[model samples]
Target: MSFFSRMPLFVLLIGVAGLAMLVPAAYAAATAWYEIARSFLFSSVLMLVLTALLGAATAGGRRPGPHGRSVLATMLGVLGVLPIALGLPLAMVLPDTGIFNAWWEMVSCLTTTGASLYAADMLAPPIHLWRALVGWLGGLFILVSAVAVLSPMKVGGFEILSSPYGRSERFRPLPESADPRNQPQFFLGLGADRTTPSARAMRVLRDVGPYYAGLTLALWVILLLAGDPGLVALCRALGTLSTSGISPVAGSVGVHSGVLGEVVVAFFMIFALTRRFWPGGGELRATETLRTDPELRLGLTVVVLVALVLFLRHFFTSFEQEIAASNVATGVLISLRNAAVAAWGGFFNALSFLTTTGWNSVDWQGARSWSGLESPGLLLAGLAIMGGGVATTAGGVKLLRVYALARQSERELERVVHPTSVSGGGRMARRLRSEGAYLAFIFFMLFALSIAVTVLLVSIRPIEFDTAVILSVSALTNTGPLAGTIHLTPSFESTAGFASNPWEGWSGLAALPKTVLAGAMIVGRLETLAILALVTPDFWRR
Candidate 1:
């Protein structure tokens, strides 16, 4: 299939996504949210007109099947376009800011990269809702894309999602065909065989989608029951499971300000992180798979270590001051519980955000307290860098890649000592030694490059290096909080150090820097290699 042929479908899909804004816009209008409604309607009209024109122009062209390059292009293009489209409404409704700043904000949200230009407290309710909605939609788009598109292409570390376990189910192969160009014919031949490879691929999506949607719905009900407003509850439910931390208000899980609410959100965040626990059908159980999965074990181990560090810090430090500032109180026993809660909250937050879901409900004001524990917040930041399972909607270096590197190092040490003894792992481990090393290296390099670019861009404004790094990492990884940087007492402008003249920083920035950051956010969410492949001429050669 030709690349150009798919352009219309892509445009139409984006327009459909844009048009979805009307539902919320209608609600806002009924409730007298004029600005919000106006933004939505105007954006919708613009998108509808543009999409219609594009669709008409390209409508009768040859349709394209799912090919590697086309899928990569579509995914990257969607990631780039959605923010640009949504930014129109934001820019129109927001204070007179340059389109670059507006694009930055929308890109942050839609990519589920939770970097925010405005402080949470300063944002109007409708604008906040729009941010949350964009995050939610972006997350769902990525999840669906992971299964339907990226999986078959074997890019973006999705190869891990197809891991073969000891008891993994086996399937029959497709029937042989005489014609080499008859690829579709071979696929059709497999339809006669119930256990064919193509059938298995389809089954994976069918099984995973329902599980994802079901968990999301369950979280939604729980949030509503926990006293969240209907709209806010819906947004969080979608955003949280998808790991998109775009919140209706600045403070994510902390926004609700209820113990039960926090607990509920914390639990859900943990659930999203543990791929093995997610309900799905297969001979292989995720828990059983986890027993041998070094990455999952390592990630969990990191969480445990972080929790202990935080617990001791809370027990010995000036705990009252930190807790009091956030309006959270705990007795000796409750303090222990709070520590556990905060630990789990931080752990899951790291897990989810690294996975690129960016959900958070923990108080940012209390970040300094965590910092005393030898900077556990930094540890979480490191975890976000490590990332979660493959084919999951998370971002960062990914735990599996880290595990592969560790395994490779272990083998290298053995080789140094004996030079002849055979390694004990399987074919997969051997493959990791060869192909996986290169991929892992590229992944980490890109991850580091993203952080560097984000830090440089964020530093242009009046912010500290540490805070800027945290924000950059969080946004690049699509994670929400940057450790102790969340301050709710003063408005976000003051807390973020942007009160006096935020735009003044822009005067120093050329157009290229702004475009680069927006590009970085998209690439980060999509994974750098995927973006590279999409733009590479060789990728389209096939």
Candidate 2:
């Protein structure tokens, strides 16, 4: 079959790619960054013209229908084209960055992975705005794709998003008629009368689009109220809830360091990590859905346990030291309050970062000093590795797959002790089989491989193993902050190097290492499975 015959999604992707450029172009004009503005305008025009031509060429062609391959093709095409298109302007406008580095930066932003190669302080206002806008748009694409494409395929840990009524078996939409929609309608087609998969996907998009936009708007307003600059607030609102972590300012959340701001971010980060908030008209109870999900349960438990451990450690060591360091009794009281605030900050910080939102407003060094919090940063790193729910914006090993693997292991252990027992009869066992553990195993293995590759890539740099692990986790999980020392700046230019001069010329990192790190960030954000699935022929075959 012709490539376009098998995959018409390229047309849709071309349109999206064209649309993506307008944001940066607008930002350039608004910020009076003429050089950047010109570059963006030129790039946007080129892309729009080219894509429009291609879209026209591909029009008036009809295929049987879209399959998993078409969906994967669309996703892959968008992922590949978007970065290059956006990067063109950056390479042209930025003082001294190669196309490769620019592409990396653009990919990281678009993937909602906050990894950056550019120093925030060094970037012009237009460029920074461009990055945040791309990140936000990237997040929206992922959210829409998750529900419209990935969920139906039962890939990307989207099993929970599967139709609760088991309408996915034949890959058909739920019947429209309340009475006529019967099980036979599911098994056999309605005698050559049926809605196409593409049609259903479009319907789902139409239904969910408003909810997505509303949530984004709500987040933007909240961030604005938190005293963020207008542009920065919009960026944060989009970045935080999308778990993208891209920021316009140098230090991100740490730049402001307000308690209320951090709290707001923490709440949104939590919201993003969950699948329950996605709007659809249903009797489905959101809280109950979350409660019943093993992954959610495990993720929440891990967060709580880690928070308690860190809190106790901070209260004893850091809090005591801060109190002693103070001269006045009032100073001691102030120190205690600081410690309390910092402890709360650290807890929420870990939670948010683990969920891969990476919003940090608290002073890490001061928190450690005031609360005796030794390496609560490491704890956050660990949580990021653990990750949040499956199919979430958060990256990492994904809690559901981990939970499934753990449960399978436990069941096997029990069966080994009692071979004759009804080991497979349990409700959980039935659920696992129906959900397909083989796929989860494959996902876990792929996740591990990605991490290994990322670690190897980072190891080529001057970073140590522990630091490499942290960086890998941060990038792969889309969780920012390296070693709890590095805050949001996206790239090593701001986060790495000496404390005295963070942006002092990428002093420690060589070109190759920077390149590899950037690549890892892109891979992590798009995710191992999504990319791999695109390449797999099996996904294309009926």
Candidate 3:
């Protein structure tokens, strides 16, 4: 086996990620962005040195087993370790920025939160590349870990897959990795199952990685051909697949993309909200084909319905002024074109927000723009809370759980409305109606509680109630930029008579509040109940 293939998956990942940092360092050198290049070199060297030390320490001993310990260490290590190392260079270069701010920027990216402290134009080219690269990798890390780590454990959205009140799975420890002198390492799924976390995680990665990688590659080439700048295309491509929405340019795909490019991007963003779009993807037996996938169907329905509402709102609201400027025939033609553009904007933005990608459509205006009117901020926030597919990079309350909870609600109503009605589907379907729905609802309540607690904690620091609410939702939804900028609130003029943005609301705050939001970001990424469940004895006893 190759050296990389032989190493435990998490260790292999650290080594590979360290080596990957070298590419940007070389680019920075070629472009004369020497300071940021130095940062990359430092991070890379430190990462490799750490990896080497870990590897040598494990030699001629029972290798560290991929159990809960491996999973937690790797997850926390990635979140805690890389950012500090990466932040050092950033602090050295950005003289005004303290260590905390530098670390926040990276943590945001590494979480695929993509909420930038510094705007794209303000940063050196290499730094922009580094940010995009880190977000891109963060996105991939989420994807690989989702199918490998989260799904198998019945955590995240996969919690719906477990039968309510079901016993934990138990299995014999793998003999191949076992040693006579060392204790056996066992993997537990919800405290029931036993397997090697490393082997299973690596197997899922091997099975799913190439296909996902190729899809991102194809997207990159298509975007490049559609007229995006090279670096912008790279970020967009990676951002789209990962749904991190990191970009080299300001605005988003809609701002830079020509008509065709927007169309292309919209198509690919579908991959974020639905796993069935990927090869070797999820199979909810309820979805026998692409058309049957519940998440996709629900997402499309939402986009179209919301788009139609927004389209009519734009068209009807603008009717008098549009009719005044042109002859009746010319007015009709112009109105039709405007309506079409508005619908496109609505559909695209709704989908984008739903996936937590954080792109505002080209015509997503604070005030009426040439293309269309502003959408309701509330609408975007609602979609963001709805979230995307389970086991996909997109973050929110995943659509699958949402659907499960909804179906369960509908079934209860049916029971109340018609006592004689038979519950349809099958035995498992009926059980899902009762037990599955309860599990999903529990998650929903936990999500809401997290938001409430976050808002309460942050608002105590003098953040406005509205600002506090948005920050809480944004962080918990894994869509950090939602609070970074806003068009809602009537206008940019603050009550104090200063022109301010929503980012100012969060960004201008003291470090303690920002730190609170950061913790919320991690909570949203990890999911609330799953983390709590991980610690309870119930999770380990099985």
Best candidate, lDDT: 3
For model 2, the stretches where C-alpha displacement exceeds 4 angstroms are 1-7, 62-65, 159-202, 252-257, 279-293, 319-336, 363-365, 372-374, 409-429, 433-438, 457-467, 483-515, 530-540
Query: Tens digit of lDDT per residue, candidate 1, span 76-151?
Result: 6777766678778777776465566677777777777665666556666677777777776676566555545554
RMSD of each: 7.2, 5.7, 6.3
Best by TM-score: 3
TM-score of 1: 0.75
lDDT of each candidate versus the true structure:
0.60, 0.62, 0.70
TM-score of every model? 0.75, 0.80, 0.87
Between candidates 1 and 3, name the one with more favorable TM-score. 3
Model 2: what TM-score? Answer: 0.80
TM-score of 3: 0.87
Q: What are the per-residue Cα lDDT tens digits for candidate 2 across 87-152?
A: 888888754566766776777777777666556666777777778777776776666666555654
Please give the lDDT score for candidate 1. 0.60
Worst 10 residues of 3 by lDDT: 491-500
Model 1 alpha-carbon miss at residue 169, Å: 12
